[model samples]
Target: MKILVLRFSSIGDIVLTTPVVRAIKQQVPGAEVHFATKPGYRSLLEANPYVDKAHYLNSSLRELVQELRVEQFDFIVDLHNNLRTSLIKLQLGVKSAAFDKLNWQKWLLVNLKINTLPQVHIVDRYLAAAAPLGVHNDGQGLDYFIPAEAEVSLTTLPAAFQQGYVAFAIGAQHATKRLPVERIIELCALLRQPVVLLGGPEDAANGQLVEAHFSNRDAEKSQSRILNACGQYSLNQSASLVRQAQFVISHDTGLMHIAAAFQKEIYSVWGNTVPAFGMYPYRTKYHILEVPGLECRPCSKIGYEKCPRGHFKCMRDIQFEPFFPAAPAAAAPASQNRVG
Candidate 1:
């Protein structure tokens, strides 16, 4: 059977859908799974062995839909569930299921602070979308496959970062989701291990500020050595860094999910967005550092370019704790999610 799974245009959201792709391939006999994502996200899925073929929406949706119709997929799994995917299913006229995004519950929580959303992780919800085909969660958590050719060699990094380091993913799609640069620098000062800053080209400027602060001779005398790897590595290369890191400190962004894929210890910092949104690190050891009582938080279901109330207290007020290489605290282990 040939099944098509659609989750277009994102680093983290697409990463979260990997289990659905894996289950459809592994559990369904002779199943051929095709994944649909935006052209720019090739790094995320191209290396995935379970994905039989990838359909990139590099052109118009109409054009892409025409291309998919030729495949004659037996079923459709719409993990994205956006207007575009809705149209694709309509055009194809196939049996399908879509992941529940819980927009109303999200609105209720964001607007009225009501906790009506399900406690299930979003990964389990994505897995449930495939239950119609007898696909079940493997309890193995998320998957991130790095091509052998793309694996970053630690020897190429600064000598200080060669042994072990903490990967600080310093970027988020929205500013409200990221800690301010000053806070990042302050946290870097608290870290006793080597530091590697990770982000996209857009985050290079902010990464530079943190890099410059740590590179100073006086700061270097007291703090861990820092390497600003912001725009230097591709997504997979950065994922390689995350895979090899002693621990990870990230914003609510894609790399955090990627770290979860590798089962890395993640210190996920929260900003305007709250963990109740169900996008927290799945099936991995993670600690959430958010301001305890912020009435202005969960400001938007997504996030704003700046805090809507202009206080930005969710990020500014989070306590910056120095990380120790001891048994992690707060977040439970991946084994606790032994059976999803």
Candidate 2:
């Protein structure tokens, strides 16, 4: 059977669909699995062995549609459940099943403060789309395959981090989801371990501020303890760093999901969003850090560039003690090192 799976964009959402990809490949006999994602996220799926072919929406949707029509796929699994995927399925005219997005439930939670959403994680719902093919979850968490060239060894980093370090992903798609600069500085100062900040080019300036703050506190120690890696590495290379970390401190962002993919102990800081939306880390050891019972919490389903409410207490009031434990006395290898 030739099966095509659709999850158009975003790093975390696409990464969450890996189980479905693997299940469809392993369970369905003679299955040739193809994944269609945006060109920017092509690398995420291309490295997976279970995926037989990788199709990217590089240009116009019409172009992608024409390209897909040639494959004559027997089935289409629409995990994105958006208008774009709908158009693709309508044109292809194949047997298709889409993951339920639970839009109404999310609306209720965000607008009316109703708790009608299901307890199931989004990964399980994605897996449901493959049920028609007799596929089942194998109990594996998530998949992220870093190419050999992208692998970042400890030796490449500073001497202090060579032993072990925390990967702090400080970037999120929206400002409200990230901790303010002062809070991040405080958080870093409190955690005694070496920290490597992870983010894209857009986060470079903010990363510099955090580095400066660390430097101002203690020049010699900050040099070894903090490394601003924003805009310095590619996505997969960043994944490599996350894959090797002792633990991860992250905002609700893509790297958090990547950390989950590697099954890293993730202490995820939540602001203007909550785990109730079902996008929390799947099957990984994690702790959600959020101010519970804030009326304005989850003000936006995704997030806002700035907090709609003036105080922004959701992010401002967060404390770090619960997420991070005390660091070791010296820069040494952590006792446990287990990764997928």
Candidate 3:
């Protein structure tokens, strides 16, 4: 059987679909799996062995349709139920199944705050879309294959982190979903181990602030153990750092899902959005740190430029004690070690 799976952009959403792709390849006899995604995300699926082919949507709908038509896929699994995917499926005219995005429920929750949505995680919902094809969740978590070239050596990391370190994803697409710089500094101060801050170019400024904050602190009292790699490394190299970490602490963001792919212990911080939205880390043991009993929580399905309410108590009021037992100690220093 020739099967085509679709999930276009976004890092976390694409990572969440790995299980579905794996199940389709492993369970379906003689299956040839193809994944269609935006050209930019090709690297995300390039190293995935289960996918026989990776199709990039580089041009107009007509172009993509013509290209896919030549492949003659027996079925299409539409994990992204957006207008673009709809157009693609309509153009292909193939038997297709799409995951329930619960758009109406999300709309009601975001606009009306009605809690009628199911508590199921999004990954399970993605898998449900493939139920008709006899694909089952294999109990394995998300998958992220970092190419050998992207792997980083532990020796290349600072000396203090060589023994072990916590990977902290200090960035989010939306400011409301992210903890403020002060809050991040507070959390870092509380951690008893070394920490490596991770994020993209948008987060580079915040990373600099973090580094500077630690640098100005009294080095004798506490060791400055934070390494800012935001915008410095590629996505897969960040994944390599995540794989080496003893634990991961992050907000509701893409790196949180990437940590899940590594099966690392994750402490996820919830802000304007809650895990009730079902996009939390999949198939990994995790602890969610959110302010309970806040009626104003989950103010948005995605996130806001800033907290709509202004107070932003959801993230501001959360206590990090439960997530980190002992405050992180000062890092020893920089040293070179290789990470496999």
Candidate 4:
């Protein structure tokens, strides 16, 4: 069977679909699995061994539809329930099943604060869409593939970190989802062990700001401990760093999910959104750091450009102690590779 699985855009959401891809390949006899995602995310899927082919949506929908028509997939699994995927289903004229996005339930919860959504992780919901094809969740959590070449050499990072350090993802897509710079500085200051800050290019400026704040306190003392890797590494390269870390401290972002893919213990900080949305670090041991008992929590299903209610109490009031604990007397270096 030739199957085409579709999910478009974003690092975390695409990573969540790994189980579906794996199940299709392993359970379906003679299955040739092809995955379609946005052009920028091709590398993430390309490195995945279960996928037989990677198709990127770079141009017009009509153009892609024309191209895919030739391949003539036997089944279409739509993990992305957007209008674009609907259009593709219409055009392809193939039998397809889509994951329930729970749009109305999310809308009711976000707007009315009524809890009607099912208590299931988004990944499990995604796997459900494939039930008709006899695909089952493999219980392996998510998958993130880092190419061998992208691995960061121990020699490249600071000598202190080469031995071991905590990896902290310091950025999120929305301002409301990230911890304030001052809060991050305070948390890092308390972490006695060496640390590495992880994020994409969008986070470079904020990383610089944090580095400067740390530098000003005691240039020689603090500067050597915190390394800012934002903007300096590609997505996979950043994943390589996460793979090396003993544990990860992250905001609700793609790296948090990626760290889950690595089965690294994660301290996931919740801000504008709540884990109630069911996208928390899947199948990995994790601790959630969010200010409980706030009625205004989870103000949006998807985060806003800025806090909608303006108070932004969801993230501002977090207590960092529970998340960090005291650093061990003898900290071990992070792992460079996964051992089978």
- Taking the tens digit of each residue's C-alpha lDDT, what string does model 4 give over 1-340? 9999999978899999999999999999999999888899977887899999988788788888988888899899999989999999899999999999998888887778888888899999999999989988888888898989988886898777888888999989999899888888888887876778999888988888887776676665634678888999989899999989988889999999999999988878889888878898899877777887788777887787787778778888887654445762222223211111
Q: Please report, in order, the local distance difference test score of every candidate based on alpha carbons.
A: 0.87, 0.87, 0.86, 0.85
Instruction: Supply the TM-score for candidate 1.
Output: 0.94
Q: What's model 2's TM-score? A: 0.94
The candidate 3 region of ten consecutive residues with least summed lDDT is: 331-340
The residue pairs in collision within model 4 are 163-333, 164-333, 164-334
lDDT of 1 by residue, 242-281 (tens): 9999989899999999999999888888898888889999
User: Model 4: runs farther than 4 Å from truth?
Assistant: 220-223, 328-340
Q: Candidates ranked by lDDT, best first?
A: 2, 1, 3, 4
User: What are the candidates' C-alpha RMSDs?
Assistant: 3.0, 3.8, 5.5, 4.2
Evaluated at residue 217, the lDDT of candidate 1 is 47
Error of 2 at 60 (Å): 1.1
- For 33-101, candidate 2 gives per-residue lDDT tens digits of 999998899789768999999888876999999999999999999999999999999999999999999
lDDT of 3 by residue, 56-159 (tens): 88877778888899999999999999999999888888899999999889888778888788988899999999887899989888899999999999999877
